[model samples]
Target chain A: MESDLVTADMVEATEFPHLSMRYQVRAVPRTIVNETGAIEGGLPEHMFVDQVVAAASQS
Target chain B: MALLQGRDRQRVQSELASLANPVKLINFTQELACEYCRDTEQIARELGELSDKLQVEVYNFQIDKEQVARYRIDKIPALVVEGEKDYGVRFYGIPMGYEFMSLLGAIKDAGARATGLAAKTKAALATLVKPVHLQVYVTPT
Candidate 1:
């Protein structure tokens, strides 16, 4: 989700605990969008798109 | 020893061949007891060497106090990928497996000053009024 509208960061959870705490990541492969939006677990491509759109529009 | 195997190296080289501008990878690492620091530096350097327009700058995370503060780096094995401008792109820890593709993509996007998102997505993104920060968590393996 970077390089265009929003800047995204790939945060290694173990290395950056501060970020994980800030983002409140509880599971692996969690995508925190706009700080407030989040999607956890593996998602299908279409569902992933919907989730991203839903999450982004929420903020 | 080569960090990237033969087939991977070939793939990386080919992918980086079309670089339009220079990309600087600012890597923060320490000499002692840092897991994956050496491996991260090695990969960044190898990628840099593959492309003439790419460069890597390795800095001691503890010793380079000024650099650490400058880049807002909070931990070791951090990489700040810079292209036309600092896009606030950061990669924490070693980008391996699928994550490595993201690294390569970021470099290409930065170097070309382009984001290959779909037109609809780009248009929607243009309408964003507030700043959004994305934190994608993944296990490299």
Candidate 2:
């Protein structure tokens, strides 16, 4: 996803409290989609892609 | 203590030798405020030292408002790994432990000017009609 229209940034939870709280993050490896959809934990590449693709379509 | 030890440093140097183009690592941190800021700075400095194609640019997070906003960096120890262009690869903490491997991989990928994504994934990405902002959060543990 990084090579194309997607831009991925890794955020450190403790270091970025503002961002963490913005997403209401309380667990590790949590991914928020479009700053809304909260995926609680790590997902497989296929699933991750699915979520992103879905979000893109919705947006 | 030095982060990259004797043989470890040598291994990293060899890996960095494969860099196809110049890679710029931009780090943002505020002194006397951010945890692991020193460690992150040290890592980027050492990594840049591994090869001439790599460069490290440090900026104050709180003071460098323009740079911070330009990169959209919202945290301390923020690192942006960019090649000829911004592929939007970002690291928000010290690349220590397992993440060090990820950092190396990112540098190689960025420097190579290509993503190692699967062919199918590339095709799928090619069909993307909207820009996606992906954030992956993780703990150092």
Candidate 3:
């Protein structure tokens, strides 16, 4: 159910709109976070922590 | 399955053998057999030599339901970092590619009981007084 909302195509379509269509198309199903911003894709732990901290600081 | 073919396996074996700590691999699938076992054991042995504190523990899930439940693992081929309180860090697939570095970092962290955060990162993290739950999913390419 969650996967449907954040399919690779959806991620590519939504996140990096300025990138080339081919690169965007290839980057689908990337990291999709819930409303609370918990990512549901593979990420290095440190990078994950960095993202989380960055998001937390923003809000 | 042997994720590495021939020369790759040898290279990985050599790298693993050079570690100063022991790294453990817990095989949770009954479907895995033979060379997989031998290869994993070889890796574990190498990881052991990596560090004085390194240790590898393999759990064949076919016989260890309690351990699986204790680890809160519901999938096959999962990795658990064992150290002060277990950390709850898990990998649902074989740690390879970029994931291997994360696995090694976790192992070293556990061995040293170290959770290293850069000063700036630590300072930022300290601002979060509330509980935060994070989950990341990844497919090995």
Candidate 4:
């Protein structure tokens, strides 16, 4: 959220039915990081940041 | 019908009062084929009414090719929360229910030209040289 290198898009699963199917979204608040890793459900702020950072750090 | 009720309206108004700069909600929608386009545009319009610092712009997703390309919008009912410069924050679909808070929060962040991410998180993000795309999938409920 603080970096210009990051772009965060909140996608409404129902409205974007095709995207939902593509991402295999089975529940609300699923976060797809770098289009590779999936974070299911809501996480605490620190944990969420950690996961996102880790995902971004991955090659 | 109004999506934001009395208490919700009050809350939004109060939250928007802290805005330090002008923010624009760039809404992309189509006249036909999109089920939630109208509602999404309405949300942008209503939020615009809540603050003088907020501006709402509506563009046809199909007709406005330039804007669509500029914002890299690929979906209908897309809303871009932009301030003086784009921070790459976007909302696709109607941000209702719980996601409403995210919209409000993004507006605030855009207006402030800063995110409330912790110092450590900011530091972590600064280390990234490659682009990171985050798509958070949610339902209105």
DockQ for every model, please. Answer: 0.52, 0.64, 0.08, 0.82
lDDT of 2 at A21: 88
lDDT per residue for candidate 4 within B1-141, as digits (tens), equals 987779989989999999999999999999999888998898899999999999999999998999999999999899999988888899998898878998999999889988787888787778888998999999988
Give a tens-digit lDDT track for model 4, residues A1-59.
47889999999999888889989999988999887888889998788878888888883
TM-score (chain B only), all candidates: 0.92, 0.94, 0.63, 0.96
TM-score, cand. 2? 0.89
lDDT for residue B72 in candidate 4, whole number 0-100: 97
Residue B3, candidate 2: alpha-carbon lDDT:
88
DockQ of 2: 0.64
TM-score of each: 0.82, 0.89, 0.55, 0.95
Clash pairs for candidate 1: none
lDDT of 1 by residue, B11-105 (tens): 98999998898999899998799888999999888888799999899999989999999887877798988987778888988888777998999
lDDT digits (tens) for residues B2-118 of candidate 3: 445578656555555444534444444445552234444444545554445556566766778888787766554556666645555665455555666666666666555555755
Question: Which model is ahead, 3 or 4, in terms of DockQ?
Answer: 4
List lDDT for all candidates, in order: 0.81, 0.82, 0.49, 0.90
lDDT (Cα, tens digit) per residue for candidate 2, span B1-141: 778889999999999999998999899977887779998998888988899999999999888999999988877788998888878778988777667887889999988888777666666677788777778787777
Q: Rank the candidates by DockQ, best first.
A: 4, 2, 1, 3
For model 2, what TM-score is found for chain B? Answer: 0.94
lDDT of 2 by residue, A1-59 (tens): 25457788887777777888888878978876666666678777667677777776776
Off by over 4 Å in 4: none
Predicted complex 1: DockQ: 0.52
